[model samples]
Target: MTDQPEPGGRPDAPRLTTREAAELLGVKPETVYAYVSRGQLGSVRAAGGRGSTFDADEVRALARRSGRREPSPAGGDLVFRTGGDLVFRTGITLIEQDRYYFRGVDATELARNHSYEEVAEWLWTGELRPGVRFTAPSETLAAARRTVGALPAHSGSTDRLRVAVTAAAATDPLRFDLSPGAVLSSARSLIPTLVGALPVLGPTEADGGSLARGLWPRLTARPADAPALAVLDAALALLIDHDLAASTLAARVAASARAHPYAVVSAGLGVLEGPLHGAASGLAHRMLQEAVDRGSAVPVVADHLRTGRPVPGLGHRLYRGEDPRARTLFALLEDVPQAAGALAAAREVVATTARHAPLHANIDLALAVLSVSCGMAAEAGETVFAVSRTAGWIAHALEEYGERPLRIRPSGQYTGPRPAQPLPHAP
Candidate 1:
C-alpha cells in the first residue's frame, strides 16, 4: 500500500487518503466516493491501484462549499433532535428537577416573598430589587382607560387589553426609542397601564399599591384580603417567566425585527389568545366551576377522561410530578375561606386524575380555583395568565433586541411543483 500524505497535506500539494478526506469533510468514506462520482470532488489512483486517494485542495474546496449551504434539519424543518431527545437553549428560565428557576433563582422561592413588580425587575435586570414599583404615567393610564372603555361592553379582558396597549403606544412620544433603558421604561409603564385600564367592579382601597391589589377589583367583586392578594402575587411571580413559551417566542421574533415594545407585546397577546396557550386557563376555570357547583369532581373529571381528551389543568408537558406553581398557589388557598369549595374540587380532581394516569394539577387549575373562590369572572384565569406573562414577554423582547437582528427568521422548504415556462407576452 502507498504511504498516505500527512494531515493537511504536505507543502508540495499532497494527496489525502479517502478516509482522511472523509474526516476532513465531516462525512463518511462512502460520501467521499459519492462526491467523486458526482464530479464535485476529484480522486486519484493509489500507487498499487487498489484504493483511491483525494487531492487535498479538492477536498478542502468541497468542504468550504458545503459549509456555505444553510444549516437545516432533514425535510427542511427547524426541528432538532438527537437520540429521540428534543432540545432548545435559553439563558432565561430553566425547567428541571420538577421545578423552575429564573436565571438560577428558584421561581417558587421568589414567588414566596417577592411581588410581581419586583420579579419583573429581577427578570429584566437580573437583580432582585425589593420595593420596585412599576408605575404608569397618569396621562398614559387615562389614554388606556379611554381606549378600553371605547370597546364593546362584551369584549373579553384580553381584547380590551390588546386595544389599550395600542392606544397607550400611540400616545407615548418615546415609544419609537429602542434603547435598553427606554424599552425597560416602556415595559414598566405598559404593565401598569394595561392592568389599571381594566374595568373594575368597585373602588379599590390601594389603587397604586401592589399589582395584585390594583388588579383585584378588576378581576373580582369580592374584597381583596392579604391571603387572596398573596395568592395573586405569588401566581404573578411564578408565571413571570417560563423559558421560551410560544407567546414569548412570538414576542422575541417581533423584537428581533426591531419592532417597538408595544408591537412586541401585541404580537405576544395575539398568540396568547389561542386556546392551546394562555386561553387554556379559561377552560380550566370553567371545568373547575362545574365541579364546584356540583360539589363533586369525580363526575366531571371522569367524563373528560372517558372522551380521551386531555383534562385541562391536570397535566403539564414539562413537569413530571406536580407543577410547582400549582402546589405553591394551592397551598396558599388553604388560608382562603371563600375558596373552600374550589379547593376541595381541585383536590378531588387531582386525586382522581392521578389514579387513571400520571397527571397532576398545573398552574391553570390553581388559577381557576383562585378565580372561582374569589368570585372572579369565568375568564378571569386567562386574564391573570396574560397579565402575568406580559412581564416574561417583555424580558424576552429585551433579550432578543441585544441579539443579531432577524436571527429568528426560519426558511421554508418549498414543496410545490416545478415552475412552468411563461407564455409569450402580447405585443
Candidate 2:
C-alpha cells in the first residue's frame, strides 16, 4: 500500500478496507477486490486509523458505477465521494393516508390529525403546530380584470409565473440571508399565493383564496359545488411533503448548486412539469376521466395496454399497494360525490380488467377525483398538482441548507464503437 505523511501535517483521511469499502459502497466486499484487480480502485494503509484501507477515489468511482440504476430501493443507493447520509429517516409517518418521514411520526396521522400549516412547519422547520402562517393570494389578477382590458396574448403561463414570483421575492430583502424558519414560513405563505397568484393575487382563505375555487372557473363549464375547496385544501396538505421525488430531487440538485430560492423552486417546477415525473399523476387523472366518460374503464385500459402504455393513477414506482396518497385523497373525496364515483369506477376498472397490470391508483388519481368534483377541467389538474408538489420542493431546499454543495457526477457508459475509419464507400 502506498503511504505518505499526512497532508500539510494534518491527519490523513480515513480509508476503507475491502470490506469497509463494500459497506460504504453498498456492494459486496469482493467488489472492492474486483475493482482493485481491474485497475479501477486503489488501496492504502491507514496510519491514524485502520491500517488496511481502500482509496477514496476508488470508492467514489464504485458509487457512481452503481447509482440509482441498480435494483436497490430508496434507502440503498447511497455511496458517494463526499458527505455523509444526512437525509436518512428516523421514522415514517402517514396522516390521512399521506406518507411522511417525521423523525418517527406517520404522515397520515399528521395530516388527518394536524392542519396544513402544521405539516408544513413539521417538514421544513422541525416543528409542528395547528394553524400555521399562510400567505394571501394575489390581487393583481383578481376576478375583475382591472387593467382596463386583457394584456397582450404572447406571454407564456410558465414564464409569467416564474418571473412574477422571482420579481416578488426579489423585492423582499427578507428572502436574502433567509433563515430556515423564515424559508419555511415563506413556503407556507408562497404556495397558496402561487396558486392564487397564478391567475391573479393577495386573498386568504377568509378572503376566499381557495385555489381550486379560483382556478375552477378557468377550467370547467360551471362553478364548483363548494366541496371542491375542502378536497383541494386536503390535497395541499397531504401532497405538500414527502422524502424525495424526481422533481424534488431536481429542486434539491439546484439547491445543492447553491441556487437561490427562486432558482431552486424553478428547477423543481421544471422537472415536475415533465410527463414522466411529478406532473404524471395529474395527467393520469385526466386520462382516467376520459376512460370513465366512455362508460367503461376496461376499454380505456385496453387501449393503453395495446399501445404498450400505462394506465395512469393505478400504479406507482415506490408504493407497492395503492399509493397512500390515493387512499388519503379518496377518503377525503367521500364528501365530493362526483369525484368519488369517478374515482371508484376507475379503481374498479383497473382492478377488474387490468389485474395482471400495475394499476395501483396513486395521488394523481386522487387529485383527479378532487379536481372533477371541484369543477376543475381535466387539463388543469396537472397544474394544481405542480402547485402542491412545490411545497415539498421548498422543504427539500431547507433540508439541503446544511449539506455540502452538489457534487453529483455520473460517469459516461462508453458503449459505442470506439474507432471509426473512413467509410470505404457511400451506400
Global local distance difference test of model 1:
0.83
Most lDDT-accurate candidate? 1
Once fitted onto the true fold, the runs of candidate 2 whose alpha carbons sit more than 4 angstroms away are 1-30, 42-103, 136-160, 200-226, 407-427
Candidate 1 regions with alpha-carbon error over 4 angstroms: 1-89, 421-427
lDDT of 1 by residue, 58-95 (tens): 67667655641222334232223333333334568988
User: Distance (Å) between predicted and true CA of 316, model 2?
Assistant: 1.1
Q: What TM-score against the true fold does each predicted structure earn?
A: 0.82, 0.73
lDDT of model 2 at position 113:
66
Error of 2 at 338 (Å): 2.8
What are the Cα lDDT values of the candidates? 0.83, 0.60
| lDDT per residue as tens, model 2, 1-427 | 1343323332455566667678767667777667656656666555676545665545655666654222234533332333433233212222333344454566666666666656666766566765555654355233213221243455434444555455546544666554676676566555655555454322323444444455445445555565655666666667775566677778777776777666777787776667776556566666777766787677777787789876777677666677776677777777776676687666775686557755577777777776655555554566665666666777777766655465433466566776786667977
